[model samples]
Target: MVETVASLSGNESFDVVVIGAGGAGMSAALFAAIDGARVLLVESTEYVGGTTAYSAGTTWIPASMHMASVNRDDSQATAEAFLNRAVGARSSAAMRRAFLDAGPKAVAHIEANSDVKYRARPFHPDYLSELEGSTLCGRALEPLPFDDRKLGRAFALIRAPIPEFTVLGGMMIDRDDIGHLLNMTKSLASFKHAAKLLARHARDRIGSPRGTRLVMGNALIGRLLYSLMQRGVTVLTRTTVEALHTGKRGVEGLTLAQGGERRRVSVTGGVILASGGFNRHAARRADMLPGADAAWCPGAPGHTGNAQDLALAAGARFGEGALSHAFWAPVSVRKRADGTTAVFPHFLMDRGKPGMIVVDASGRRFLNENTSYHLFGIAMQEAHRTRASVPAYLVTDSEGIRKYGLGMVRPGGKGLQPFIDDGYLTQASTLDELAAKLGIDKTGLADSVARMNRYAETGVDPDFQRGTTDYQRANGDANWTGPNPCLGPIAQAPFYAVRLYPGDIGAATGLVTDTNARVLNRDDQPIGGLYACGNDMQSVMGGVYPGPGITLGPGLAFAYLAGRHAAARAASPEAGHADAREETRAQTS
Candidate 1:
């Protein structure tokens, strides 16, 4: 239940207090409440979803119940083998084993107990499908579309979708909807589907603030929020945790500030920090991620590392020396008419499409265009070490733009004047002219284009092997009749280019915790009455972006464990006190 600030008193208490109402925090609260614990979920912003509301809502979990239905040969051992190769020695064996064992149970429990439902993507390959033990399908799970009208007035609490992805200003569309809308002119069946969606959206705008048909991350958050409401969980938005109230036994409660009033809330179970991450925290980024900037990040403004700071102040240790400090992606920026900047993340969008290539400032192709976004970002970082490759360019031909669009420019979009005028996109009739506009070496760009054309004609990228893996081919345009779906000649006139920058999507290094999601000190001793999940917890993949939704999969699984464990401890009088004493002795020794 959503609570008002006036109802809160300085003397309020609960069995468990969860800080941050993102996917992890919300899921933790729901599981705890279902386990018969009095739970309170707090959010810094008025919205509940945080960065998750803006995501694709795909959770990459191997050996999930969703996978079981598809009859894939995925098991804990196979998943462990894949992680060992992909994550290498960066992550602990216990953490990887725990996630593989608990992921399916967490998904099944939530689905059976609440409105949350997920379906397996039949052909979504792991990001590194060439690696052994990586399956071609039945691992990634997408949340089913949800009707937000069920929440009634509470629906407003959910964060809205990004404007660029929506159509007609506020209507949300999923992958299937986009396909239908794109083919509406081709067939009567598609036309009917498009018409029906438009009609519902139009009607929805009349009585509602936004479209009620929610998809992607919004659907996942909506389902979790609705489940929390049904379980009678107390949720307070626009409330920030000021400080953790720690005693000799560890964190006993927290001091929260809401609307200029500070309130003290006591908790016996534990405090779970799931406040997205430190992506937007300037100091944290500067200290941990030296080259990254918050301005380039697309994470929610509330992810300011508040939870990480509070945990650190309470003696929680930070996970150090991961494969990378943060998850990365390439982002393009364009100023909107309202003066605010529109940042577009090129995730499986224009990069994998044919007739396009990302080139460095020297106008040379440095990496495979069909590689995963995370790997692409890493390559950008590597290039920056030797040259000014931070602001690389994604160059494509007129045919590419008309078919796949570039940045915020939609496919077949009319009136390209605004984009050209605003300088979000640049166009040139000749390769030399395009090179001049981009301020790069004309000879290098011309030679690169010639090589790309030769590769396009032969349907092979000998330099980088653009479409060798199932993962690469899956992201490419399947309708093209080229020898390789990801390779096409950029010989069309009026070539275009968009500047790209390496952006940190989320933090990978965070509070180090054990398999039970209990926050641990520098001595590897669990701090009593303290736990973490989401980005607040050090990533289980050890900062490696193995596939889509790797962050959320372990986040949800460990959060489930945290909730169950906290509730069980709260039910026992001696457990919490005894554990604190044991940890204290271990730390001192």
Candidate 2:
């Protein structure tokens, strides 16, 4: 679907020019186009779908009307209360109300406009289950099932999640459903799944592929984009937004680059920059989050805050230390440089997959073993104050090796054992030898080990108190008998260690936006024709991951708002909302 090229002398115009063809951008484009706005979506990659394409592909909305239809107690008031509590008292009053008021409408509009169907996950809770205002269901909603063929030739334009998160996902499965798949392997219904998969493979052999569909985040975007394309939104991949130009009132146009060429477009409606945050930019990371010394982001390489810079140029106010980092489970993988390093989050989240440890510079326990990804990063920040590079250990037993398949690439050999054989990992027959190998006070190591053993025996940690919280205990091993879930102690023989620290998925800091997504400028004025969403701006949830699809949820909402507003402007330029302002300072630092 290539469009004919045309040269522009003064300015190029469209109803909306959306930067970053990821979830939010794509969502906005679809809505804008539907609103009868001439929409143009620009992307840096050869294909659309940003880091979200690498995600499990679910959209989570709590107290959703969809879930309530399935027999749950979800009302608009309850939804507002949940978001208000999630944001606490640190948010713009107008923005918070706007998010609550407009969230459901956004969901409904997208559901009706896109090829995707919305489904409420069976039972997903907002993080912190014990909280008073939390709801057990109806708050989280995800994209329903979809077929990849709907995209027609544009199927390849979409990317699927990495196998780990997407193997069972259909671009729309709820995050909790991931844990369920491991449980569903024997849920009797597996017999039908096996047959369907076999049938699809057989059809592939005959060249009559039909129902081998795209699901989860991919499915969600595929369906959304399918509808968007049908409505005539032009998604320009491998294209970049070079500059944002203002008119008499506010933003009026943008300069774009593609294939070593640049083009300027006039946007009568506006420009929405949802290009995502700069998680991989070390310089930006060091400056925005001074405590986040080490980051192992799982986001797209192109996520370098280009949109944030553009928003800043237009005078958008930023949130308070709206940290832009993700919590990784800490897994060891071979880096592109052929060096071995740990990928946080994935390692810690899936206990059955692999196991690792975390220690301080002196090879001592600094935080609870099983902590929230956000909290763990904070601990890492605190530890970095004493040294240029803090030393930590990931001690594991031989069983941890065989059961979880723990391994990391080394110069000569692979896995942590070589590190033990070499001097990289401290190895010891007794806890004393292991502590000696770690170069710490042996007594302290032995004492730590003994304390851990006691906790494992009773399933109740005394010190730092691991597995004590409702949410923190969710990741604990099932076989453990103590009051804590992930607690079983580290008393096994032939202990192993690997160096580690706080490595986040990405940063959370971004531009301060009203609930309706109208970016407020430094002077507390609306930029008239501009908007920003996704990681390029401050997270709606302020970097605290509450439940599944946190980023996707609000990102999708603001996106819908941006598109709705853009389309409305395209229809009538004077119909803009008047009061989206700069009081969003409490959102980030």
Candidate 3:
């Protein structure tokens, strides 16, 4: 029942207007509608899901109802303690508290009122498991698989997953699906599961462009979209906001343009900015993240800081004191058949696996290879200051490559010639040969390899302690019957390597907002009828990537807060004025 508009030629009115059709925007629109407010969801792109669709869809919400299903010992107090140790003073305590308190409520409300549902991941560990009060599981939730066949022709409206992430010409798979597909020939149950998936995908290809079996972030987006459609929300895609119409009270309306036609839209509740972030903004990137290359970034393209610019012009200031201006990950680049560059983020797939070692230009190990992708990226940047680590080499021998794969190279090592032909992957028969081809110190490379071999034999990486942490161990091959799951000798011939660059995944510094998710002015006063969430709002983690789905977790929670606050404002207009003044006094004081 969703109204998809092509041209905006008439003056319209809505209670809540949400910019960007990402997870945050969709959640905000849904929450507002649930509160009896007429909602409008807008997107600059043709599809609904943003960078989220390209992700693994791990939502980190502590102490939710699903937690006890996995780990009954998980408590809000324990989660808070973990945050205190991991995040500390990098972000505001109030914002963190607000997220913790509202997260479960948001999850519960959405599940109760809509098609969206989540279950706790059985063994998803916190990235920083070494930190105090960290639990092995129960915090991160996974979206259940959704049938896109229910969407019919509307299936195309959902954004497709990354090309490299899919298999069999766009058949999307999840963690569970991956295991089954890999073991299909060996196990009967896995074969049945994989057979069913392949059968469904084959049937879907007959009519649709891709598979109708949705999982991960696409499932989350599809569920949200379906829920919004059921509620009759108006969605306008490929539309750009030209201007904001504001009065003394605050943002009241927006000037939108679609297909060269302009229309004025009034909003009685508020405008919520969830337009990703400033990662794609050239000016912002130059100002905030110097020396970072956009070619390395794998985020969605619609996040160009357009909404943030409007808020800044209205006196909204960016948050300060973040450890880094943006979140980052180490990515390998390759040119696809479509002539577009594919920047693949190396997160938890091959880096932490045995027989892998990343080396700098001097052919020296500069970091713990098993560390989180965010820390790995930061280390690359930090190492670049002294040595040439911008394009670090991820070296793995033939055995390793065959077992774990490198970058875009799929496991089982069937289609490696294409990767090598495109110069995306470097292959050499010997360690010294690889060093020579990569223009690195041959002696340094040999020494590093020897040291790694010894460490592998002893099952202790004394240099960087690769397998010391629980997270690292979990990321390794559990089937390995060795002293250390994350350690293995790189003695095989025909080494493979892929170049890695630091990629800014999302912005951490963005428009400042209160605990209620209302955008604030330069003087710390709430801008009535205005709000921000997702990457458009400054990260509550203060630029730290604590665990999987950190971005989506806070994004959904704050979107709920903003939606409820805006709906209440719509119910009582006078309360908006009083709440604004009270918030101003409280923040300024």
Best model per lDDT: 3
- For candidate 1, the lDDT comes to 0.87
Per-model TM values vs. the true structure = 0.98, 0.82, 0.97
Stretches > 4 Å off in candidate 1: none
Q: How far in Å is the alpha carbon of 522 misplaced in model 2?
A: 1.8
Please give the CA lDDT of all the candidate structures.
0.87, 0.63, 0.89
Clashes of each: 0, 57, 0
Q: For model 2, how does the per-residue alpha-carbon lDDT over 433-525 read when each residue is reduced to its tens digit?
A: 776766766776666666766766676666776766555555555554455566655656776666554555544677776665767777555
The reply for model 3, stretches above 4 Å from the true place, is 1-9, 579-589
**Candidate 1 per-residue C-alpha lDDT over 118-205 given as tens digits, one digit per residue, 9 for 90 to 100:** 9998777889889998887777899999999999899999998878878887899988888888899998899999999999999999
Superposing all C-alpha atoms, what RMSD in Å does each candidate have to the true structure?
1.3, 5.5, 1.7
Q: For residues 6-31, could you state the per-residue lDDT of candidate 3 as single tens digits?
A: 34447678889999989899999999
- Global CA lDDT of candidate 3, please? 0.89
RMSD to native, candidate 1: 1.3
